[model samples]
Target: MNWPTAAGSDSRPDPDSEYWDERQETRPPGERRDEIIEKIGEQVRYAYDNSEFYREFYSDVDVDPRNITSFEEFEQLPILSSDDIKQEQKEHPPFGRFLCIDEEDIARIYGTSGTTGRPKVFGIGQDDWDRIGEWHAQILWSVGLRPDDRVIITSPFIQYLGSWGALAGVDHLGCTTFPFGAGMEGQTEQAVEWIADLQPDALYGTPSYALYLGETAEERGHDPAEDFDFKVMFFSGEPGASVPSTRRQIETMFDCEVVDQGSMAEMTPWMSNSGCRHLENGMHVWNDIVYTELLDPDTEESLEYGAEGVPTYTHLERTSQPMIRYWSGDITTWERHDETDCECGRTYPTLPKGIYGRADDMLVIRGKNIFPSQIEDQLHALDDYGDEFRIVVEREGALDSLQLVVEVADDAETGPDEFHDLVRQEIKSEVGVTPDVTVVKQGELDRTQFKADRVKDKRELAIDV
Candidate 1:
């Protein structure tokens, strides 16, 4: 199939045309904030006027949406929690009081996986769907996927909205999308064979799936780095892509650039803050579309640059089920674009390290705090270990035990006995808690084609018993 490409000397797009919307992306910081504030006023007023949820939400807080004009006023508004959405959805059935558009105007429906509980739902208007595609296209373009790129979306077309958004952006960009969905029997094998046969230019899926695909390709006797023609791989649905060692591993396996992009399901346009082609650990926040804030999780006040805080998102353009001050539990440190001097020339706020993990995911063990990413970074940094791993936290008598079950790669030079202490010492130095590191043979640990739930906390089960 033929694909469209812009006029450039090389196969890639011209460097001058790097940004999808140069004027909007590179707008002065002062001007961008002013624009965001203006949009905030409009969205708030629209939500209050249209949706009963916003009307009552604002009413209960004794704050008038009409009174909110500046960014400061917007910050003063009440924050929306995931629990709040779940409760409202349960009480209201399908779309809650947050449904702004008329039922007849609804164009599409999507929701969370609900693996934990009843899924939170969202109703999308046609205009909003179009905008979602446009915003995603901007992010994809920023990460070096040109119109000529042949993209393969490995995520399934399921209740989750991650893959659909990528499909929309790829379609919008006029890229040839091979929607080779995952999770079916023999799907990973097929994905590997197809990549070898067709040679797609890019791939989109969770970081774990990308890694698994590399392993699958290897098991099938195909060297992923040499066999595939992928120039870039973008991931969502997990923090592995943002982890330095994991990113390095994927890049090495696929011989491609890895870009990390995603957020909570409530924010359907999850690519609000995505990686730019230029910077490592750089994800620029498209604040104009979705007004994003890094607020102190406890105080709900805006955080300064370089401070770790919860990512709070307020939809500036979403009309149907607009999320205002939605507190996503994910934690990360951010800096201003000017501070990073990103080569992309976009003045959007950048999450320099991408997302660290959810605030709730942190484990307090033996009076020491630890995150799964900390262990993951240390584990993948070693040459002997494979990408698959499991973090099991349990309460043993009076103390907490952190157990790491990891897979040893097939081509490792040394045995697990020789390298086990090296793994234990590296993790101890980083997270301050020494874990019981158990090394298993390759392919011993379970693998998932979607988000990998690496951490299994047996403490809750112990408490229940």
Candidate 2:
């Protein structure tokens, strides 16, 4: 089957309306399901027909993509992992067998951040890129960005797709955009100065960078809340935007709303699984474009609402490089469409708490499972907590040691001894782990203009030895 054309722009929703596409966003569950199932069937058939990877992978398991009709049948298909992508790319090079469109038709190429090893490459066709742009425009509109609003995008223009998608959405919505990318020598200070000078209405970047930007503004002797004109801040690449403590901190610092949203880089329209301006505590999974299934990590069984599971995703619209049942390693609790009470009227399933951190990032110390976010939530609750902190886990002989290197706010009034005891007591009482708390003065800890890697597992060094 030939790849389909982009959804017509003539039917695009009115920019000034309350909902981006009221019909699509607020459709009843049964109606949406029927539409989604049909699309899934088409996508599976197309992938089997056009992509060699899908044909081989499915055929090996005796699963025919053509026969897959329901979610139940689709679940029988093997889950795709990052390792699978890495191996395929290594064998096939560049786009691998996943590239369905002709090489000349490839419009854009992006990849993973490559923090660990070689990044996984993704090829996108012009039609797919157009759809991604439209999806994001709908997403950004859900968060109340008007056509006339001025937006400052702080994401670095690398292989990363988050910022690029945001810029596309901004353009589609007719908003004035300043692509002030981040991660340079003095970009933070310069970006702060630009914000002060221009007073842009909206900003997009990682949640950690937004907090760091507030600190940078303070260093420049400017109060962020008073000096900036940001009405809303959209964040991704981390969970801080949805974390209660971190979210409140940014909101109080900038006097604006914090909208937390993100998606896997392989799954291009990063904002497809995002929160609207009116949705609190969680984000809506826009299933029309991307279908997400929460499954038990161990058993691979589909999880019901209120259960914690890994978000396995399938692309319904992507034609160039489609991912079916791709595993997202992050952990989060979700609610069914009818279970959530979103005032925005969206019927999509809600992630009551945004992604809790990667499953691999969870630390098993002293037989107690600990998430860095649990510690972050604890620290940000403290009145004297600074903007930066790091969690270090090391092996001490046979037992594991968890040490928290935290920073005290510059204007903190509490004594180091008293504050240290308070931090230790809080974590022990709340998180069920007694940690060795090392307190440093503010600005002593390293900062990032992107996703902050707060955890350092030194236990690996011991293993290597």
Q: Write the per-residue lDDT of candidate 1 for residues 1-465, one digit (tens) a residue.
A: 011112111132454588777788888989888777777787888889888887878875645697576776787789999899999988887988898889899999998888789888989888788778877877888888888889999998897799898998888777899998899989999999999999999999998899889988988999999999999999888788889999999999999999989876788788887897887874778888777899897888888898999999988878788899999999999988878856878888888888878989988898887889888888889988876789999988888999998888788897888777888888899988888989898899889999888898988788543
- Please provide the root mean square deviation of candidate 2 (C-alpha atoms, Å): 1.7
Error of 2 at 292 (Å): 0.3
Candidate 1: worst-modelled 10 consecutive residues by lDDT: 1-10
Best by lDDT: 2
Output the TM-score of candidate 1.
Answer: 0.95
Q: In model 2, what is the error at residue 192, expressed in angstroms?
A: 1.2
lDDT of 2 by residue, 1-465 (tens): 233546436344566688877888888988999888878888888898999999899976655688677877888889999999999999999878998889999989888877788789989988888888778888989999988899999989888889888998888777899999999999999999999999999999999999889999998999999999899999889889888998999999999999999878888787878888887777889888788899998998999889998999999877899999999998988998678777788889999888877889889988888888888988999999977899999888788888999899878989898889999999998768799999999999989999898888997766443
Question: Model 2, stretches more than 4 Å misplaced?
Answer: 1-5, 8-12
TM-score of each: 0.95, 0.97
Best by TM-score: 2
